[model samples]
Target: MKSELYYNQDRKRRLFVDLWKEQTPFVDNENWTPPPLGSRFHFYVSSRQELKKTFGGWRTNETNYGFNNLSYDYGYYNSNPIPLQPNNDTFKFRLSSYNVNGVYGPIIIDMGTIETLNFAFFSGSGNINSGGVPSTPAFSINYYTP
Candidate 1:
């Protein structure tokens, strides 16, 4: 009986790991789209270290629809010599409704002098659809230096 119980536990653990792997995003690819109904996702922006200006937007298909609740946090690397001003090192924004029909936009934002940055996206309650065909949202981040 003990051996049977152990087998069941191990099987459950493997199943959970498989599910997580499927949900994990491939951060290395710029064109990699995230699961449309994912509750949370994050990516690092270290390649555009010299970029001082950044703009980006998101879009979703009709089947996936727009995000009911969305929020994001921006974090910069702390080791950099340049000191980030107040409200520069960390920031968060909430969007109650993001249009699903069209592209969100070329929203400009200050990236500061930080070389490495982390961007995370979170979906609000009832926003994620756990089952069904996985849909990926279209998004982009453009960087520029002056």
Candidate 2:
């Protein structure tokens, strides 16, 4: 199976990611886009907390940090909206493990404006006989200013 991803940021500063996917037996393909930013954007993680208690606030080994464990803090990675600087402003974030491909990681995108933004993703791989069949993709965004 293969996949692709896409994202769009409308004038309202909203973001959405879509995914297209196709399998070998199933020649058909489908696309799905995730919700925009600030639409119930929240994260529950414990990587930082795990390392704090295990390693005592020091970077010794990478394995100390695990997933979904109370050893670390479970909070939103980005709960606050990026401040637009004077003259030129850019908003960037790292995306990891959206589906399971492990190929798409950390993408930097420009926050064009405070409007509605959308994005998408597609996944698939085949020969000349088969078209570009991608797996389902998704992305979401949220904004908060202080």
Candidate 3:
């Protein structure tokens, strides 16, 4: 997924990653393949950071879920939306294992406008033909900025 930024004054920000995955099948063949189903999941911001410059910098929002003990249920992650403060008008984003594994994004995003309402970025992964595998999934982000 591509990193995006909004153009507005600072206010408040909260983020959640919704992941719909296809469980990879055991079978592998040139002519036939199985699709990953029943894997529509979301990670409600388990851990976040003002920056990923160091391991000590990260703050864990929820103790029950982490990279070690991953849960398929939505109740494991944090759902309560509290306005998050960005550091230096910048948000250090790293989506790890979103999991059996979570998604760790190795991307940096400049904090966008806060006042502008409705629609920032929307991304959907996987397809009917089983496009994305477990290791590397395929997704695209629809970006809009006012």
Cα lDDT tens digits for candidate 1, 41-74: 2322111111111234322212222333434444
In terms of lDDT, model 3 sits at 0.24
- The runs of at least 3 residues in candidate 1 whose Cα sits more than 4 Å from the true structure, single-residue gaps closed, are 1-64, 80-88, 101-146
Give the Cα-based TM-score of candidate 2 against the true structure: 0.15
TM-score versus the correct structure, for each prediction: 0.26, 0.15, 0.19
Worst 10 residues of 1 by lDDT: 13-22
Candidate 3 wrong stretches, greater than 4 Å: 1-88, 101-136
lDDT of each: 0.25, 0.21, 0.24
lDDT (C-alpha) at residue 139 in model 3:
30
lDDT of 3 by residue, 5-56 (tens): 2111221222222332222223333443444222222122222211222346
Query: Mind sharing the TM-score for model 1?
Result: 0.26
What C-alpha lDDT, on a 0 to 100 scale, does residue 12 get in candidate 2? 16
Query: What's the TM for model 3?
Result: 0.19
C-alpha lDDT of residue 32 in model 3: 35
